[model samples]
Target: MTEQRKDILDMLAAGKITAEEAEQLIAALERDQAPAAAGLDARPKGKVKYLRVVVDATDNGEPSRVNVRVPLQLLRAGVRLAALVPPQALVKANASLSDSGVPIDLTQLKPEQLEALVEHLDDVTVEVDSPDATVRVFCE
Candidate 1:
């Protein structure tokens, strides 16, 4: 065990820190050390290429299912295309979207922002489960 881990354990044994506090400290240490400790495993595994959504549901004795996989490259292409659209058209579209309760401004989107969003997507997985349905959205 590392000296930090030993210190944490000693603190716990001495009642100087609560168990939960010790666990949290250990977890933080592990997260901080993971990349260095991983060595060869720290290399990128693979690029995320797709955004996926899956749904399964039953409603009033009827069942439904849906599965979707969207290419990440398509999103990049769309962002590029958005730049080609006329500003007036983008304004109109933005107004329409607002009217439809989508409060988004197309004119504000930037390539760098989109790239950041794509990077963050790799760490995001959304899942919902209820008595009647299950839904998941993630990147792969």
Candidate 2:
């Protein structure tokens, strides 16, 4: 444990802060220290808690909107669970996805690689606008 973490724990033990506050402090410290501690690139790998999609549109002179928020933890769990799937099932799933124009290989979805991709996605925001609607996809 680092000195900062130890100090946070000590504060928690002394009732100087709540458990929730201690957890937040620890998480913040880890995020700040991760890049330097890993000895890899200096890029920060922050955990994404949610994947958000928002759409605003005008339909026949009436305004409409759509909002979707998906917990990223579910995605992580799904990737980990995929390892238990049979190879034949994975092949069939891949075929189905390809048929639906997804063009993704399910067998290649390693959790570590997915985590790295999600980390990069933290800085990405995609937006599209058409005559009728505007769509946005981002991580938070």
Candidate 3:
């Protein structure tokens, strides 16, 4: 473990805080070290959990790079935002994106998520595989 993690553990062992507090601290530390949006907290009632999606393409046949286990909520939100670009405009845009190899339906995202999606769309490559609902957004 790193020095910071060790310190947190030491604090825990010394009874400076409860296990729950220690857990939250550890999670926050991990989140800080991870890539943006790498950690997701628990969703409220009627929300999703444990959704996974993997989006990858080969660059030289040795498995270029991959992003796995993305949140369904994020994907839903992005598609939702794409819904606001005027129905005819959205239709044209979706048609333009038809060769991206993933099936995307833009009208099902929540309002808040849709807002975030519009900003994220330019930076992501979305993928959804069969038998699961998660989405993979491979960043270029």
Q: Clashing residue pairs, candidate 1? A: none
Best-fitting candidate, scored by TM-score: 1
At residue 125, candidate 1 shows an lDDT of 94
Instruction: Kindly indicate the candidate among 1 and 2 with the higher TM-score.
Output: 1
Each prediction's TM-score versus the true structure: 0.62, 0.55, 0.28
Name the lDDT value of residue 114 in candidate 1: 76
Question: What's the TM for model 3?
Answer: 0.28
Model 2 lDDT per residue over 44-135, tens place: 66777898999999999999999999887776777677667898998999999999999999888776887777657667899999999999
Span of ten consecutive residues with least summed lDDT in model 2:
37-46
Off by over 4 Å in 3: 1-50, 55-65, 94-140
How much is 15 displaced in model 1, in angstroms? 27
TM-score, cand. 2: 0.55
Best by lDDT: 1
Candidate 1, 14-57: lDDT as tens digits: 99999999999999999989978787677776688999999999
What's the true lDDT of residue 76 in model 3? 68
The number of clashing residue pairs in each candidate reads 0, 0, 0
